[model samples]
Target: MDAVPGRKAPMASGSAPDLMYCQPCAEDGNKILPDAFCPVCKEFLCSTCARVHRNQKITKSHALQDKTSMPSSFCAESEDEKFSVTCQHHSKEFIKYYCPRHDALLCGDCVIENENHRSCMVEKILQVAKRYQEGEEYISLKTGLGQMVRDIENYILYIQVRMKSVDEENLTNINEFRKFRNEINQYLDKRENELLAEIDQTKRTSKTFLNELKTKYTNIKSATEKLQSDLHAHEANSNQLLIVGKRAIKELEDLQTALEKVSMSKDVSRYTFDRDPATERLLASETAIGRLKEGESTTTLGQQQQKQEKKQQEQRKQQESKQQQHKPTQAPSHKVNFQSSVDLSQSQFSRQPDIPMKTSGDTRNCFLSSVACLSGNRILLADYNNQSVKLILRPTWCCPRLLCQVDHGTCVNCPVTGQPSL
Candidate 1:
């Protein structure tokens, strides 16, 4: 039987026609195991062949498991699966190594039973908390950046709307100016036509009056010549002179009337067409029209004013910008300062031995010390053994950096485990 179920026999290709058999057990007539196992030598085999080794009688004393059964669970690698744990320091999956002092995750159970951590100050180790101040600073910076972006966006939108309104107003003013120009042109044309009509009428009336005066003057001259000829023929009679005198008087009266009409019709120097006040007004108006026709004298006073004002405005703007630039932008700057000395000669406890915290790098660690914030944002930490004043920075709570490890022996005024003088 095959080790696993549902196995098939292996086939071999050859030239023989009638009897095509497997190459492993070729026509030997050994008991053919079915498809899965090796068929050669017939020790429960299949069509394909595999090597089979037989041990001699001397080495057969070795104990071996039966091929029909699986491996034992006790000897299996999975037997220790229940003891698997994770390492805290290395952050890896490991077995137990216990910490006796902290009583936390441990790979070795014997570690918790040992006294290696007897001197460790449990109270001081437990005092360390999570950092919240740094988180607050990050949030504040994010809020400030958001507000600045919003303010800039609002200013840009305001400027666009204002510029659009100004453009609309300029268009309206241009339309009004065009309408006013058209009305003035219409008034000028009407006035010019009226003046021309009055001049034409005056010329017609004067010409008619001149023609009538010339005819009357010619008739009087002809009558005077006829009387002279008659007087010469009748010089012996004196009564003819009286009739001639009366006729001359009548002709003189007609001549005086005709002359008065001619004098009234003639244009005086004071009131000639060119010099007339009304015509002068018309000429002045025409000159005004010509000026108007030449196109409007559009003076951009606003532009001129803006150009003039720009200098001072720009100066003022620059001043304001400079002031803004120079103005101190204040942000919260965290400063951590350590005091001069430390004293640690006190604290008698019953159960645990005093463990002085050991620092490897540029940090100073202390155990079982009372640190407090004082006036003027200074910190005072009581170091009992060191017999000196120790200062710690507030806010950042950085480890007490050694500024001056002053010995109380040298400074006579300094007292042990007391506040330092400012």
Candidate 2:
């Protein structure tokens, strides 16, 4: 019963009542079985309550039902039904009016007391509330409440799973970061050993070249000293010693020329060992190995959810359309004479099809192979030459439209925009 006023939403679908007890007993939070039925009050009363009710001054004249005559059980009414026959504000008066805009049940005293109730459109509660629970709106309300509860639960689970995934991803990233750092350390250590070996090689090559030059110069100096001592041992007037001295001097000049040539050809000049600026800059920055990129997983998950929701919406639309197509329509209240409504004797011509049926695929003139009549005076025509179907409007309506074209040999399949394929 839609007697609830100032309610947030409709009640959910409930199970059938199985517990049988006195109405008065249940109302007073008790569970005693009913012994008698009060027809005037529409209440199931227990033995003690029936005795008290029968002795009451107001209900003494009313007839009570026999214990055997009462129904096997009484279904418990809602709290709204308890206050349905009377108003809470006006306890002494019966409910007389209902405000449609506010969805409020009111008594005559309430209508007279409130200024807004006097101006607004009011209806008799008996007229509006008749078969209220059986109406479509009420049924949909009950269904919507159940669906909303399920959606909320599913959404809560989705949130919890997403939060857990994010935590796991964070741990995975931390481990990845540590692994990457270890690899970098190993690479730098390898490069450092190579650089040290290269420096040692350069030192050994330069020192060896210098030592060979020193030994060649020392042998030349020793040979020139021995020749000078032998020449001094001869007399000052000896011609042989003078001639030998001259020859030795020429040889010494040739040796000096050879030393200059060797120094110019294979001497160690200079070298530079500068650090790589890119590597230095990278080490100085906060994110040396790699920067953390975030939100990709969350964004992908949201996109997937959106796609799922879109797919579900499409399925619902398809289902609803199928239901509408299969739904049984009510027959006309009055008889419809089909022969009188449509006169087949009359001949009608439409020039609309002449223009569209002459496509490139039509090798011959258009031929109406078959024709079918649809509701609302619409006609469906099949063209044999063009292999196409057209929806021709009635004389009352405007024009004919090409609905679909099948692929006959090389012909393209053209269907109307926003129309489903057959």
Which regions of candidate 1 fall more than 4 Å away from where they truly are? 1-138, 208-212, 225-422
* lDDT of residue 391 for candidate 1: 56
lDDT of 2 by residue, 1-422 (tens): 34322112333579543444566567557778778888766667889988988997766766888688976554444544544466788777778678987888888788889988888898866445543645677889999999998878877888899899889988999999999989999999999999999988988888888888888778767876877786787657579778877887887787778767666666775567889999999979998799887654554445778988999999999998778756664443232232321112333433442334355666777888765546775777788877788776655322222122221212211122212212
Error of 2 at 179 (Å): 3.7
lDDT score for residue 196 of model 1: 86
- RMSD values for the candidates in order, in angstroms, are 35.2, 21.2
Q: Model 1 clash tally? A: 25
Which candidate has the top score in lDDT? Answer: 2
Ten residues in sequence with the least summed lDDT for candidate 1? 124-133
Query: How many backbone clashes does every candidate have?
Result: 25, 0
